[model samples]
Target: MNLYQVAKTVVYGALSPIYRFDVHGTEDFPKEGGVLVCSNHIHALDPPVVGILAPRPVHFMAKEELFNAPILKTLIPKLNAFPVKRGMSDREAMRKAIQLLKDGNVVGLFPEGTRSKDGVLKEGLAGAGFFALRGDAVVIPTAIVGPYKPFKRLKVIYGKPMDMTPFREQRASADVVTAAIMAEIQKLLDAHK
Candidate 1:
């Protein structure tokens, strides 16, 4: 197995019994091909929880600073994370994610572009839509509801895949597509939370 699979197995073994995350909608995840798993980021645990629970490996875009931190420098990459410069247009990182998706891999990121200061969901930036369009990947709008106390059964729901073809054909703006994706995520939060 690859590093991602092995690490996921080990992490799942350790975290499942402790966290016991209430994961939903695994079936919505496509069994193959390129996919963009966009979600609302709330906590530090958000990415790991979704990564471990996802049926497929998710290579997430992490803040560039994390890669230079003591142990995270070595460990984060093994978890299938790549450094992404935040608060600016980082062309290098964008190209990397687009290439990864084009090569038929799953790429996960937050539409808000950072953790929510409050637990409430916020407006999504255009980055997710940009990736969806450039990679020609299906977008999975996911939601994680949590204040994330230990032993709390937090919920993570993966909604249906959003095909970007309509947006592409219509030449829809990235902002419009991202708004729709965020709306879907909000709907999931409304239903489950």
Candidate 2:
């Protein structure tokens, strides 16, 4: 198996037994094309949860500081994670994400930029929006709801791609797309909760 498949298997093996994951809307995820998987950040497990539930492998953007650790620096890239410098514009990371999407790969990220610490949703950031536009990706609005307790159900829903046609015609800014993406996620959260 490929490294991504191997790691996914290991993570699934570890998490599946501990948490009962109730996933829905897998059909909403497109089988092909550049897809931007945008979601709300709730817990540290959010990324992996989305990654595992996704029908395809996901390329994740992690904070640059994570790459400072020796083992993580060695291991993270193999798992399809790239580092982004926080609190500043990191053009290199953006370019990488755009390239991945343009190549028809699925790039997943939490638009809130950090963990919420509490289960409450945080304000969205514009990076995900920019990535979607620049990569010409179909932005898939996804949501994960959890305070993550053992044996409690962890819910993940992948909503349909946000209709970017209007936005594209209007030449919408990344900030505008960010707002729409966040609102859709909120709806998914409310429905599932």
Candidate 3:
């Protein structure tokens, strides 16, 4: 495990009860090899919950500004977290994610591109779809519910993996395809609610 991941695991474990994490559908995660994990963005807390409870380590994208603090700069990269520019496509970030997939590691994505304002799943951007198609990796759909009241139980559901082969050679309308993926995320969230 990466050093930052180790630290994150330790910290999250200590705080798990405070957050009341309750995870489900973990069995849906592949036992081995690389996979693309896409999930709904409900809150900033979502990534920690998913990363901590997941059967495998998941690398995710975070806004670049979050790493500006000196401590975070050192910690974030080690935790498998990378920076992405908010308003523009960060090609370098995408390459890093793809490289991780090539190295047989799970890369987590928030296809909606940003957190949901009202905790409802929104339309996803095309960035995630393009990565899945290019990497030809299994896409694991996921959803996170609740950061509700104080110490309320948070639910995280991992759906089945999606094969991108059929859409591989298709056109580059990543946004269009991402909408389909986001729909699955919404369904999972609804089921758990």
Candidate 4:
């Protein structure tokens, strides 16, 4: 395994039982191709949760504020977390995400933009749909059922890739695509309820 894989495994193992991580549809994760792994954000732990549960290495875009803290500043970027300015489209961050996908790495994205305080999937921002369409990458809609108890059981279900070819060709509205993707994620989230 590579260094990142080792780091991911160690972190996940150590945090396991605490997160009680339950993963489904990992087999649906592409083994050797670029993929856009999009999920609803319900907690701060979403990035690490997806990273640990995903079959392939996953990269995430985080808020620039998260890197303001000294400890996180040092750690997050190394863990493949890049920064996006809040309330603005951080082109550089978007570029990095596209690069990762182009390089055949899985990029983790939260369509909700931020954690859902009510544990409900929020309206998706354009980032997830934009990246998928722009990158021409496969869209993997993931739903996380619970962040439950901090150290309790949580279920993360990944659905099959949604083809964006039509969306691309038709020059579909980003809001429409975002809503559709969130609905799909909500369906998965509802299954666990």
> Considering only N, C-alpha and C atoms within 3 Å, which residue pairs clash in candidate 2?
none
lDDT of 1 at 21: 88
Clashes of each: 0, 0, 1, 1
Model 4 Cα lDDT, one tens digit per residue, 1-193: 7667778989888778677777889887788768999898887778888898898878887779989997989877778888888787678988998888878888998888778898977889877778888886888999988756867778899898888889889998877788778888988888876
User: Which candidate order results from sorting by lDDT in descending order?
Assistant: 1, 2, 4, 3
Tell me which of candidates 1 and 2 scores higher on lDDT. Answer: 1
lDDT tens digits by residue: candidate 3, 78-116: 788999888987899889888888778888988887788
lDDT of 2: 0.88
RMSD of candidate 1 to the true fold? Answer: 1.5
RMSD per candidate (Å) reads 1.5, 1.2, 1.9, 2.0
Off by over 4 Å in 4: 65-74
Worst 10 residues of 3 by lDDT: 168-177
List model 2 lDDT by residue over 78-109, tens digit each. Answer: 99999999889999999999999999999998
> How many pairs in model 1 have backbone atoms within 3 A of each other, for residues 3 or more apart or on separate chains, i.e. clashes?
0
Which is the leading candidate under TM-score?
Answer: 2
Poorly placed runs, candidate 3 (over 4 Å): 169-172
